[model samples]
Each structure stands twice: as C-alpha cells, then as structure tokens.
Target: MALDEAALETLGLGTMWVRRGAPSGQGVVEDEPALEEPRAAAYETASPAARPAAVQSVEAKPVAREPESQSVSAAPTESAPGDTPVRPVPPETAKTIRIAPAPEPEPLDEPAWDDFEPVPPVGFDPAPASAPAARSADIAALDWEALEARVSNCERCRLCEKRTNTVFGVGDRAGDWMLIGEGPGENEDKQGEPFVGQAGKLLDSMLRALSLARGENVYIANVVKCRPPGNRNPEPDEVAQCEPYLQRQVALVKPKLIIALGRVAAQNLLKTDASISSLRGRVHRYEDVPVIVTYHPAYLLRSLPDKAKAWVDLCLAYDTYRQAIPNDKARS
Candidate 1:
C-alpha cells in the first residue's frame, strides 16, 4: 500500500515516492530534496578510505588543560586540527631576600699587675761578676767569723742565685779529722749545715763505727758552699771561685788526715779527674795532709753493697790518723 505524508513522517522517510517502473514523466512527483542524515552527509562528502578518520577527528577533539601552578610556564605542545590552543602562564616575579650582619666580639679585661709582686726568673743573678784573683787574697786572710760572713753574702758564682742558704762548714773548727763532700743538698741548703739529712745520719753512724762523732774530733765541709740547683755537681768555674775559702779552712784546721767523700770531692780536692775506685785503697796527699777517698752516703743508700767498701775506707783513714798522731791516746 502507498503511504501518506503523515505515515511517511512517522516512519522518518521522504514525503514523496513513485511507483516502481512507472513512465518517467507520467507519474513523476516533485518534492524538496530530503534532508540528508549527518553521518551520511559526512560519508558522502569524505573519501571512502578517510571516512573512519574523519569521524574519529570529530569525536576526539583535543582539550587544552590549564597549568596546575601560575608560577610555572606551560610547555609548548602540538594539537590536532580541531583542538583549542594552549596559553602560556607568565613566570612569577623574582623574590627579594634580606640578610643581617654579625655582631662584634666583646673585649677582654687586662691583668692586674699591682695585686702581687713579680717573681724573678730562674738563674737570675743581680750582682756583677767579680774577679776571683782580686777576691782570693781578701778571703784567704778572713778568720772563721769574717769567712762565714763573706760566704753568707757571697755572689761569686751563679750557684748563689738559687741557693736557699749558704752551706758553710759544720762541726769543730779545730777538729783533727776533716771530712769534705761535694756540695750542699736541699736539706743542707735549708739548714745551712752540711751532712744533716739521711746522708748525714749515715755519716753519723759511720763516725760512731770509728768511735768518733761530729764536733768531737770530726769537721765537715763541702767543695762548694752553696747548693747547686737540683743537687747537681759543682762546675769547674764554681769550684775555682770557692777554692780559696776551702784552702783557708784547711790551713786553720791543720787536720791530721782528710776524708774526701765521693767522686766530686776526690776529683776537686786532689785536682785530679781520677775515679773514686782508683783513688781508694791508698793514702793520697792534699797540701801535705793525707787524703782518703770513699763513696758518698747518698750513693751508698742506693748501692747497699758498697757500704762495705766505705767501711774499708774508714778503717784506712783511722789507721792513717793513728800513724800521724802516735802520741794521741783518745782513739788509740
């Protein structure tokens, strides 16, 4: 059956139609060209091979997204033909930074010098050096009183600078038996007396062994009156400067026999650098008086075995004393 306009409109077909195989001019009905379908129009206009691509282009239009941060610029990107163009974001203005300068350091206060007296450096000698030759004559003529006074005020050598007290000879002035040692030690320097320490005690013991005591018939002296710093041996110049005092003592005492204790005493008294071992076991002479050498008490304390040798030296000294004073009966 032939459809009317309402039926054709409802069926979504063209409004007019012709019978099949009818004469071209006999039943021809003219109507406005039917509105073409959108997809069909695109397919008819586009080439058959490009129809799928044309449809895809319309369906997949590219979108231009805004950048997440306003400070950063969007990178340039390519787009398909129908896509929107992307706008670049301008860079944010550079930020300004400020810095502060460091604070200056505080000044320190100066030390107060007026609070205390200044100490002199070690080995500081204030007195001028005097000639030994000029002083020797004056010292030689001084009796015990003047000699001691001179020694007490002596500045002959640098050893005087650090000495606590001058160690003059101790015991009887007129004693027949004289014992000479090296120099004053710390104890002797403080006491201003020689052989008064542990060494002094040992010496007293040794004297008792010989039936003798200090200040009885025994006199004690040292090579150097002043103590060397740290109990060091007296230097050659120190010995030379102090020799006149020792010589004066020897002349006054006129000891029958002299006992030179230790290597320093033996070497300095005899003017020989001979070892104590070589100087021992024999009677040596110093200014016409017999001299005997022995180990120092300080040395014996460290070397207990050598005490026997020191005893032998004491026996030798006693024998020499008896030989010199045949008429004396106190020790006989």
Candidate 2:
C-alpha cells in the first residue's frame, strides 16, 4: 500500500521523493496530482471514521527516517501539542576585550637642597682662637722705643696671660757684652727686670768679678720677656713669639760677645738641644756674635759646685771680648 503526503509528513519524512518510473533530471513524478495542501488540511480536519484506510494503516505502522548530515539554520517554529520548545544557539565570533591599565603612582613631594642647613653635633663647644703673632719683618723694622711699646702690649702667646710685667731689658743699649737668660722668675716679673732676685745678687757678684756691671758695658735680656706660671720653663711657642724682640736687641747692641746663662738660654741662642754641660766648653755664635754658655745664677744658687763653672764661662767671655775689641780695657 502507498503512503500519502500527510502520512509521510506525520512520520517526519517531509522531503519530496521520485516515483520509480519518473524522468531522470525532472525530479517530478508524471501524471501525479498535487496533494500537499489538500492532504495536510484533510489530516487536520478529518475525523477518525472519515480518514482514508491507507492513511490509517500507515499511521498504525509508521516508518522512522534517518537523520541528515547537514547544518541546520536557526529559525523560530511553532510547536505541536504536548511538545517542548528548543532555543537556537548563537554562532561563535572573535571578540576583543580591553582592560584599563592601572593608574600611575604620583611623584612624592621632596625638600629642595637649598632649604637644608648643617647642624652641629650635640655637646660641642668651640674654643676661641688665639690672636696671630706679629711678622718677623715688622718686628725687625721697629726701633727701640717702638719695639718697647709693642712688647708692653704684646699678646702673641699664652705666657702674656699670667705676666705681671714684660721684662723688656736693662743696661746700655750699645753695650759690648749681651747677657741673655731664661724667662723671668717671680721676683724679676714683679720688679719688671731680669735677674732681680737672689739670682740677681749672684749675677752682680759675677759681673763685679769681671769688673763689669749692669747699665755699664753689660746689657741684660732673656729668651722670653714674660714670666711663666709657677716659674716653669717657657714653652717653645712662647720663646718663638718673643724671639723677634731678642733678635732686634742683639742687632741694636751689636755686642762683641754674648753670654747664654743656663740650658734654656744656651739652647735657644745657639739653636742646639745639647745639654748645658756639653755646651759650656764650646764657643757658639749667634748673628755673628760669639756666645759663651754658663749656668744661670738661679741654677748656681741651687747647685753651688756649678758656680765655679759659671766663673770659668765668664772668664772665657772676657777673653773673647778682648780678642773682638783689643784696645778696650774692661777686665781680664
């Protein structure tokens, strides 16, 4: 028995089929009537008793159709009673998703270098600097009165701080014998003169032994004009500061011979660190003047034996003086 169009459609076979004797390329059956619309309407309207026996027989024995290997286009379609509706899936496409970059960090506000100032460390206290000493050239150019004035007001070293007076010097300015001693002691500082203590008495006796006296042919001075505190030895810097004054005095006096009394005087005058004992026998020269080393009168007071040595040094000085000035008859 042959199945009609409505029965084939009901069984999901909606595609047209060619008859066995249909033309080869025409794809239509010859002499067949058009049955699509009329058959589909009849299937919908006809009752169970009114339907064709062949259609009813085909419905009772339905044929299953094989699934086609083709892509289906998504389209909306009506559903029959008791059927579930299917949703169409959309085709995949290449999409571009852009992510905003993180915001850049703001620059920090910094202080300028010009606004910074240096800070000194805690508990720091700076000492006041001492005044600069006078230049040698300036001191050399000064005359007697000018040099004395300068020495009176000099503050070139720390020794000036404790001095009661500056012992500039005493005796004849043109004396042929120049006696240089160490710094002043307590009595000399108070009297504003060099060797005015018990040391001064010993020095006077020595001077009389040679037929010389202060303010006569003997000019007296010292390595330093100011007295050291506690009668301690004058420091090297203190001696250096006062050296110009002594040099100027030597220049003005133009002494025939110089007597350096004690280790300090001998060392500084001869510019030697040799001990007084080693220096005693030698004839040293200072600014072209013969220098005789002797123990200081103050030293002689403490050391009585060395007094004899000092007399020998004085005798040597007198001999040297005679050689320098032969005609002058001071003493032997």
Candidate 3:
C-alpha cells in the first residue's frame, strides 16, 4: 500500500519513507494523526522545495519483517492499510556523533644546534661591498673615439701608475659579442689588448672554433684597462673606477652576448665574490644582456683538461646568442 502524499506531510515524513510496499495483512492499529497541531503546521508551512528528501518516522507498531535472505542492516518492511511504508526499529542508532579532530602533530625531534650548520638567508652577502656601482655620466655620453682616448690616458686608480700601455680593448664597436677579462696580463699590457701572448693565441683558437675572430665580430676588453702590478687580479678600487668605462662599452657595443673569462672577471662583472666553479656552465645577466662564464684561456693553458669544459661554455654562449636574434640567427 502507498500512502497519500498529504498523509506523508502530515506525519512529518518525506517521500524517502513513502516508498511502495507489499500489503501487510495485519490491520493498522490506528490512523490517528501522528503530529500535533503545532508540528503539523510547521511541516505544512515549510516549503516543499526546502525539505530534505530522505527522512522517515517509525510508529509504535510492528513492521513486517524482511525476508530471511536480506541483510540485518537493510531489512525491508511492508505497509499497512492507510499508512506510509513501515520499517524495522534500527538496532543501533546515533542521535548525534561528536568527534574531536586529531590534535596538531608535534614537531619532529630537532638535532642539537651544533649538529646542524647555519644557513645564511637568501641574498645575504658577507663580502665587504666595493664602492658604489658608480656610472660615469661622462663615460656614458662619450662617443667611441672619445671613450677610447679617455681609457688610454685614464689615471684614476693606482693601476695607472704602473701600466706600460692602457689596453683600450679591440673589436667591433657595434658587434653582438663582447669578451671581458680580469685585467691586463704582461703580454696584454705590452701589446694593448685584453687577451694576447699564449693566452691570446688559445683564445683565438677558441674563437675560431666558434667562427668568431677577435675584432671581426667580437669586442674584447678587460675589467681594468691597465695591468695590475705583477699581473695580480685587479683591486677593488681599480674595478670600481673602471666599471663605468666597461658599462659605457657595453652600452655602445650593445652585444647580444657577453662572455666573462675566469673567476676575477666573473666576480667583478657580476658584483659577487663567488668562485668560477659555481658561476660557470650558467648564464647570468649584465643588466639585461646575457653573460656566460668560462675558464680563462690562461687557466686552460695550465689545466689542459679544463679546455673541454671551456668549449662547452662557448657552445652555450653561441646557442644563447642565436636565440637572442630577432629570427634566431647569429652573426659569424
């Protein structure tokens, strides 16, 4: 027997409890209204659209038992005349279940402070800073000839006191490749070039390997134009004084790629004290231009095995330069 829709509403029940069922031969005890006036009014006034679909009520009467084959958890019941479907009393019921959430996990056992090494925060530089990365407005504004003349006679630092000739760099003023070295070596100071002597020869071979000649399509320069005493690395003041000249050179040449040779060259150009081992095989930026790092030709002359690694860095620079092209083409 299926109960009328109005009867289900009056009994504070929903369609989920009003499923069709086989007749219960046993007669219903009472058809008296189950809900009092207040309850019936609440159920009637609640909009049908707002009601839950799956609720039921049990009367104080025996529901027909499910077939023996049915599971105890899902026993089916029969309906009596003038009543909605009846169901068996639930064996176990939960009026409400309150579960406290699991507690926050305790932090794992930390080792003693001595067992761990300290890590500096990101961008934490311990090295003493050199002078401001000062740019010479004068240098920035000078044309090629004026800039070259200024570098040749530059006496701005102690290096100028001892250098034989100021190596004013050589190559295409408007080319797309620039080479920066640390400072002038003995051969460089004498010959007025960035890379010369045996190192210069090795550099020439390396450039030919990439099909770029020294002054043909590449501009070669040093961090400081003058040689440091005894070919020592350029001092902080020397590099600081000369940075503007190099910056101007970069601004003028507008190279697609800048290859920094060795540790001193890499660190000074990048404004860091990091070693070449960490800097190599990676592309850094000089402002917006791409800079690649490699072993100095002088270092390669002594450590022949590193020549292979230098070759790889050059290849990376070549590939990067090709990518900078408007259409992925690089000048030879």
RMSD of each: 23.0, 22.6, 22.6
**Tens digits of per-residue lDDT for model 2, 77-116:** 4455665543332223326679999999998898878668
- The candidate that wins on lDDT is 1
Off by over 4 Å in 1: 1-131, 327-332
Instruction: List runs of model 3 lying over 4 Å from the truth.
Output: 1-135, 327-332
Candidates arranged by lDDT, highest first: 1, 2, 3
Q: Assess every candidate by TM-score.
A: 0.59, 0.59, 0.58
lDDT of 1 by residue, 1-332 (tens): 11353365576453333223332222222231332244346656788678755444433232232233532333333455665543332223346667777877787776678757678799875544445565787888899999999999999799999999998898889999999999999999999999987999999999999999999988999999999998889999999988998999999888999999999999999999878899999999998899999999999999999999999999999999989897455557
lDDT of 1 at 15: 34
Q: Rate the local accuracy (lDDT) of all candidates.
A: 0.80, 0.78, 0.77
**Winner of 2 and 3 under TM-score:** 2
lDDT of 3 by residue, 142-215 (tens): 98899999988888889988889999889888888999988888888888877878999999999999998988
Model 2 C-alpha RMSD to native: 22.6
Name the TM-score of candidate 3.
0.58
